[model samples]
Target: MSLSRQTTSRRRFLQGTAAAGAAAFVAPAANRAFALQSPNERPVFATIGLRNQGWGITNKSFKFADFAALADVDSNVLGANVEKAAAKQKKKPDAYKDYREILDRKDIDAVMIATPDHWHTKISVEAMYAGKDVYCEKPLTLTIAEGKLIEKVVKETGRVFQVGTMQRTESGQRFLQAIALVKAGRIGTVKKVTCGIGGMVASPVIPVAEVPKEIDWDFWLGPAPKVDYRALPEMRQGYGGGVPLYSNCHYSFRNWHEYSGGKLTDWGAHHVDIACWALGASDTGPSKITPLEYSLPVEYKDGNPVVHDQYNTATSFKIRVDMPNDVEMIINSAGDNGILFEGTEGRFFVNRGKIVGAPVEALKENPLPEGAIEEVYGGPVSENHTANFIDAMKSRKQPISDVWSHNRMLEICHLSNIAMRLDRELKWDPAKREIVGDDQANSFLSREDRKGYEINM
Candidate 1:
């Protein structure tokens, strides 16, 4: 045989041997199973933020998924959840302090983002880029600009996304009933809506506290301006840890503008969402926002708070918005914590617990058309919010609380915050998505994110 022909045959034999060796190295049961995973296999999930709402999703979502990983900046919380997941499912999952580590894994099929409001947009954008469906807790964005970033990424990556607004999937369907009634014209026309989300209470200047040993304080700060950790007891573990802290860190992060839009974003994320749906204004937003009256914990000038510390959001306030179709909305810090729809024909109040009023009352005699609530739910009733997300992932369809509509509802809340802070009425160009005329108000549409943590447009 010629020397050239013999050399070519030797090279082919070595290449085949190397390939066989590589296959042999991937023999671990986990790695082998991952390679053999079927396309129809139940999605394996990793959760990024796990405190109040994070744990709430954890408890309920286990049935529909194989919880393969958990990530948290808090070591104590991460370890506890890892143990809890093992006990609950008899399957111990991996744990990581940096969520990006979880995202880089090829085995994770989706992610649940329950981080503080400021972190949602960044994590979600990256998660979809990593080819994972996402279930992000609301309010879906910290600002209008973040919402735009998310919407763009969602379109670019056709991943199924669900906002953690479960009112649309409630068991008794009270919110659904209310929305159906309002949309069905039972109230004649939704002329105005009153959302009583209650007022914010400012925390006094919090003394700088020692950072918890278990937490990565810097990572916890994320995109927010650098500040000392104000140690807080994790709040509201039961009700998705509703407002975990009152002093403004950890669970109480909602009370500060640097992190959240106060109660405007907290409760408004839920109530305003339903109100938008009922009015058929989910895709658009209010044309104008007027702050009738409000008080901040500190002074303000030029659309920013005068005081840098303490709880900086509005302490108590009433904000009014004029949406399309000449419909009006009054958001209040007073009265029962629920949403009221008043139309020319009738009125009714509905909350998480029940739906009550003349419209709902008349339902006994003049019942809604059958399957009406289900239609509002996007098909059959989902077991819960997470279930709806999983179902959407399976069908390649949008979930009940989709990103576009949630952002629109959040735009109302964010605009309300802007007006309250500036202590005046502001007009909005919905198509342009800018605060009309007032350059300062328009500036509030997005925030100057901290370096390295910036969310790209």
Candidate 2:
């Protein structure tokens, strides 16, 4: 049962394929359970960013995949997670500071990416070309243009790609049921949806500090601007602890425009994705994104944040999106931290904890059609998001949370951030995937990667 017991024949098979510059063995669809049979049967995996969510997805996948390598710019994080993974799987994996080392290894069948928002596209696109399927965390890209590149690479390489929007598969299946309810017409004619993604708090000016010796600061800032490493003395608590709470690195990166798009892309990537899915707008996108009201933590000129030492993303925002079928979507940083679907027939409120209201309540008397949830999901839902990814790997098909749909929904989040940063409404040509007639706003679509760190392919 142990990986150390893997047969020599399997190693030679992988090595032979690698030497020939071909892909590793593809598991058949019958291996959907992912239960280990022989030692060589499990899919080989490597994780590129071993932070909070990075460790999270990998840790949950021990039963289904054999992790051969782990990579991260932070030595401290990489070493700790390697030990944790070894403890779970009983096979210590090789660790590296450079993610490219993982990509170069021909044996790694798939890579789980949990880098900051800016690094997702580069790592993902490269991984696909390197003959590895990718399961990247969302929001998948920092900009709409980055998303387009990912889509292009996925098409060019013909790789199985999964976006980490677990709500579509997990969260106790509440989100799945929510979508099922919409499809079943439990809430006839959805008129509007409100996604309250919570908010960020402005941080005090963080002073530049010494980069920890364990971390490679330059590598961590790959493709992003080279700036002085900044942090405060106070360490964060609870989730994403050990790093400075107000720093530009680590968990607080979500609060910076340089690395992330604030709550709009953070939680909006999750909630808005579900909202669009329910509205049958996953393939298409909004016609317009209007920042009705918002407040930012820093001043800006030409949509660029003036202050770099503090959190500059919006602290509170309410954006109105003109969705298809005249459905209005309100993404705000106020009210309950969940989604509210209002329709002519009934309304319901759903989140991680529960799905409630008249429509959900009436399911007892007038139930959804058999296989309704599965139908909404395209097939039987997996135990979790990773299970779905492994299943997709086996089937050599797209997972439930495919990249194209993720990018389409994620465009709303990115556009919301753009609208807020520039303080203007944006007319979107969804067919063209551009901001209409706004040169200044369109300029923010893609950022020039820092030299020497451009994407390899």
Number of the top-ranking candidate, with lDDT as the measure: 2
Number of the top candidate by TM-score?
2
* Model 1 TM: 0.88
lDDT of each: 0.79, 0.86
TM-score of each: 0.88, 0.93
lDDT of 1: 0.79
Candidate 1, residue 435: the lDDT equals 86
RMSD per model, one decimal? 9.6, 5.0
Q: Give the per-residue Cα lDDT of candidate 2 at 252.
A: 91
lDDT tens digits, residues 63-173, model 1? 666788999998988998999999987989999999888777767777999988889988898888777789999888888998998888888888789999877775467
